[model samples]
Target: MSIPGEGHEDVRADEQKDGRKAGGYGLHERANPKRHRVIRLWTVVHPSVLGSTTLTATASEAPLTARLYPRNWRGDGVPSFKPSGQKGWPIRGQDLVRLSADYWWVIGVGVVLTLARFSEAFLVLKGRAAGLPLALVPVVMVVMNVVYAATSAPAGALSDRIGRRPVLVAGLAALACADLALALMPGLAGLFVGVSLWGLYMWLTQGLLSALVADTAPEDLRGTAFGIFNLATAAALLAASGIAGLFWDRYGPSSTFLVGAVFAALAAAGLTLRRRQA
Candidate 1:
């Protein structure tokens, strides 16, 4: 009988053993409890200097799928599928529609108030027209600014306790009185008093408007809300001055002041209506 070659049989047995080791480790760990051995599936092939290929199997506790490709894969070892980097922040049109009614109310009231107030340049001109000495005319602004600086913090604090709407309505009503004082009275005294009242209105409304915007806006979007609020009121104020100037040139300063009074009165009435609705 012809006998099988011993070297060929040994090589075939070794190949079979390596295949079994690879398969068993790929599915689960080894059953040796004492050694705590970890088994992993691998198809390891190495070419030796002798021009022979060798196959080998080994046990390892860690998986190679993620760790082996650090740059190409995610932290968890899976290939990264997310896009790299991010774009800069931008305010979209959807931001306008997302603002609430109360926020819009605050912005609207601010715009109306700004329109009625007009520019302090007109206030200085009114002082001069009321027979104020040219040098003393600037005192009108000084007094108003002093009053504004003093009362601004107090007005904001009072609104925090009593609520923003009441304070804003009161300020608008005071603004109406100031406008009427400037229109109807005929002396330096009227200019001073009207300008003082103007300062009072600034104290009452400006900081409070900021607070209302903060209260109504989402925390993340508060800055954007304030920017919108300021922009709307600023544009209104510019338009209002142009309109007031037209009235002043055609009908006189009294007509301009009278119109401002009317606007302030209307704003107050609207605020009252909104409060009732709320």
Candidate 2:
């Protein structure tokens, strides 16, 4: 009998060992508790780098089957895969037009309203047909602002539920009516009531518009979008208020509300476009 060469047999045995090393381990082998136990406490969390190193067995390609050896000879299994990178983000932009529209439209409306107060101040004085009472007009403004702060968002949600068009139209109409009420109402009490109504309406529409923007804006771009939206509104208000101040002096109380109504009515009607979104 010819004896196998010493070098050839050793080479074959080494090949066998390599092959066995590549072949994967079964769960039973991993779960075997009776054998030596390994408590691998990972000190630093290494992100899972997959794609290249992550190997999957192709049934046909590896006819020369391989086995996975433990990192050490003790046969402790490989650690489970961990996902890398961060989580996903939220919705955004012109696609969220309802939100953007509300932000712009409401801002336009609000800017006009905020600046118009200065105009309303002189008008209220002149409307008194007396040299304006310093206390009365200021008090009206303060109370109106308080009401505005109190009532804004619920009204917006209400508007959202009922339909933006109707609420907007009604707010504009009420705005017009409120001004008329103030223009016509002779007593301080009556003026108070009228101004209060306008503030309440403002609260509703402003909050509603903001909510619309928040709801629509994508998670990442929200701060930028909302900032721009508000800036636009403020700019418009600045123009309106400046021009409106002159108009207040020129045409007096009647012009202020009339102009406000014209703009508001246009905006309210403008909301008809949103019907499709509903």
Candidate 3:
């Protein structure tokens, strides 16, 4: 009796009109005869690394950030700067300055996220085990995609309105929590929650990067400013997609998401660097 609905369980209980098990039948389960009472190590391994899939998810989303931030280096003339909003924000000047490397930190986040994308596949695999109707899986997936699309933009926008550093850092921190949840839960619901929040955090790039450009580039030089920023980001994404795939195939899925958490930490840490320097 190795748990019902799983392997090695040969009996089932069915209730009758009398409220007693009458038509109970034997469930055909092909037991692994290596049943020397020793549990398979792989079974244990899964619980230990359950959260690994989320890390994989996070790693793969890294590259998108680079594409959104883009640098332009060849434009000329100073764009007029008007004082608006809070006067003390660091990014107040990042709006008009033009430098590719100025936003390099965003590129780094992209690398880790691109790697996390592979985690998406593993997350799907987890779905297969849920015993959900095969016919409904496709529908569930479509619905979920819509949910993600709806949620991502707002997360990024919220960060911008509130403050870039705080939003970026908070999203990463929430991701860290989501990753842990992925590792600990024993069912599909865990994957759903983790992946959904993961998507929301991933969505932060568009607004965050847009603000990065706004804060740094001069109005007169927006063309050159955007060009240079985008180029570097594209390069990081190219590397992240290729290498992150390799990492996922060679190691386990969870390893990919784990790497994502590390990169997120590094990015969060890097955000601090600008404040100290300024």
Candidate 4:
């Protein structure tokens, strides 16, 4: 007898209905064939480090048992079994269509945000182009990380008090400003300013996207929802980096940043429209 579910809880339930005790279905000497019995002795012949031959033997009588569960179960009471409020594999495509509009909007915003921001390596190239010395280029990363670490917690807290949309919009605007600063300004000062702004953008956006995913996903499918959203954003990032690189190769560095700014602006606008509609 099986249930249309997989998990220790469902397994236990099925076992109870079938009058089987917990752990009763697992391996025991009586249930297993002789061939499955544990080996008592094994020998190894090898040369020692000094090149002398050595023979080693070990013996034990301990029995090992492994429990196996059916991957899929069927039972008359399956329809009565409540959902576990946890994600499961073999999910269907229709499950995605069942998500709320708000959830889709959040995913859209995340995709657009990812599409706008290429790899941070572009920041290093921008700094180099602005006349920052090669040896000191890593300082841009150091400054950006310091600011991101410091602000992330506080910004997350602020979002909890206010809301997600406002903070996300602010983050997108900050990213656009950062792109402009990197494109138009020159020198170490511009690099630091742009990097700092990028950090602020990250602080505002990153955690919020995860939170939005949690808020919108169905109780039983939250993990699947998160997986889908993350996969989409990761794909967007690849596209963004490739497009940025192509633009940088052909049209100069400023064109790449300009395109990023346009994408960010578009994301912010889309988010704003969604919020108003909500």
Candidate 5:
């Protein structure tokens, strides 16, 4: 048999004579025809080798690389696939009801906590009211997010070690304190303190609640549990914001924050009572 690329030189010569260049040796569409053909043939012949090499390199270099490269990595069993039917509203409604009944306290905490915290936009408004410059108002959220990002990992780790309830209680307390500071204290310093506390509250509570939902939910109903929990909390947040806006327009910022503080206190008390009962 003739060598695979033996006629490539003659083909190039013909192309040149016909006023067409043989294109450069690259992997793109305009690459040398013979080299591209050889690459395609090699891939066809050793498809698994090429794919596995790429996968191995990717896994080895990915983040948390040490964990990715397991010493006993193996694929011995065949994966089972099944066609699942869509769940109807009736079935989903029944699940929602069951989840509500079984995990009422978890759902309750989520609702009350959401109600206790309005949109962060209110915080920016509060900062503005406190004499923060229009341009520098964005700094309020920046500081809050910085504290939140800095502490969230540590808070999650602590909750994992100590348990979710106590950590959540502390978070509610932080929220109450934040609301108190925002409502009662004066000036930008107070705004920053409240903002920081708000960040701490978020860092402490948000992840813990998700972990709590996962812990309490049945494996088969985890997705349903999350769906219902999110729905309830979202509704509560909407209502809370509406109420806060009413208070802001009618009474003032202090009343708005004070209302949030009251709700936070009530939620914390409810959680403590629930824990004792449990």
Candidate 6:
């Protein structure tokens, strides 16, 4: 009884009522029970297809992106690849040995400097010995951290204007003063002074040392350089702390800091000599 296209028109009207259009598919079309069921079945059958395609496309573009914007990839304005225009994986052993040989002075300086840096726990213990109330002992660390945060930016800026060597020498001098104050100076006054100097020393030297490493190392082997630098310093720090603890138990806390002061002075002198030579 219907015209030839009347049934099709009726189906289209029903689809429109269901919020779907004849020419295009969208959220409304997907909301249809039949279409939703078919889509779910297709997804189940090809679960990884979409994911694999997306991953492949990203992986393909990553190298090109790294090449185009090497600094962006490195995040430190250093290029992402070898500097000699050679393209290949670097030989780790040979490169590391060469790096160590070329930068042995930096490594040696780091070791000497770290040997003067005993654990902060010793500082807290020193505060206690200086008659800081048990409850207020934590104030020592708070004061140190505050000074460290305040001075870090200024110290880094100053180093940028002058040089890393001068800043690092100043830091070593600060550490020597801190050690002397903690060891020889009396009372809570000395404790606070020592803690503040300790913070200043940290702010002046830490970033500059890392920057020095970055400046000296090749772009391709920076990770290795940093790794080795950290390892050397960490080992020295461990040994220094252990020696300090030994001195604390036997010769007493004052002797511990005196020994630290001696090391700091020696390191500072070494740095000065190197600076003059350069």
Return the top candidate by TM-score: 5
Candidate 6 pairs with clashing backbones? none
Candidate 6, residues 1-278, lDDT tens digits: the string is 33465477887667667764544456566569797788888979686888888788876454665676666577544455665675676445688666844366788888888889989999999989999999999999999999999877777679989998898999999999999999999999889999999999999887777887887788768888888889899999999999999999999889999999999998899889877877
lDDT for model 2 comes to 0.58
- Could you tell me the TM-score of candidate 4? 0.67
Of the candidates shown, which would achieve the greatest lDDT relative to the real structure? 6
lDDT of 1 by residue, 1-278 (tens): 33367687778778889999998865554455334332111213222422342122323322464565466676554577575454676566788777889889878877887789898899988988888889887898899999899878677678878988899888998899999989998887788788889999888887777888998898758878988988898899999999899999999998999999998988888789878998
Candidate 6 runs further than 4 Å off:
1-93, 100-102
Give candidate 1 regions above 4 Å deviation. Answer: 1-89
Order of candidate numbers by lDDT, starting with the best = 6, 5, 1, 4, 2, 3
| TM-scores of the models, in the order given | 0.65, 0.50, 0.51, 0.67, 0.70, 0.68
Q: Mind sharing the TM-score for model 2?
A: 0.50
Show model 4 residue runs off by greater than 4 Å.
1-89
Two-way TM-score contest, 1 vs 4, winner:
4
Q: Worst lDDT window (10 residues) for model 2?
A: 38-47
What is candidate 5's lDDT per residue for 1-278, written digit by digit as tens?
A: 23356687787767676653334333354556777788888878797888898888876442442345443233432223334667666346666555634376888888898889999999999999999999999999999999999987788688879889999999999999999999999998889999999999999887777887887777668878888789899999999999999999999999999999999998899888988887
Tens-place lDDT digits, model 3, residues 1-278: 24446532333332233234232221111244354224466676777686788677776452443445434211232223435556553333454344445555544554444333334554454455444466655643554466668877567557747878677666666566555555555566766776666665656544565567656655656665566556656676666556556655787545545665666666666666765676
The lDDT values for all models are: 0.81, 0.58, 0.56, 0.80, 0.84, 0.85
| Number of the candidate with higher TM-score, 1 or 5 | 5
As a TM-score, model 5 comes out at: 0.70
A best-first ranking of the candidates according to their TM-score comes to 5, 6, 4, 1, 3, 2
Report how far residue 54 has shifted in candidate 2, in Å. Answer: 47
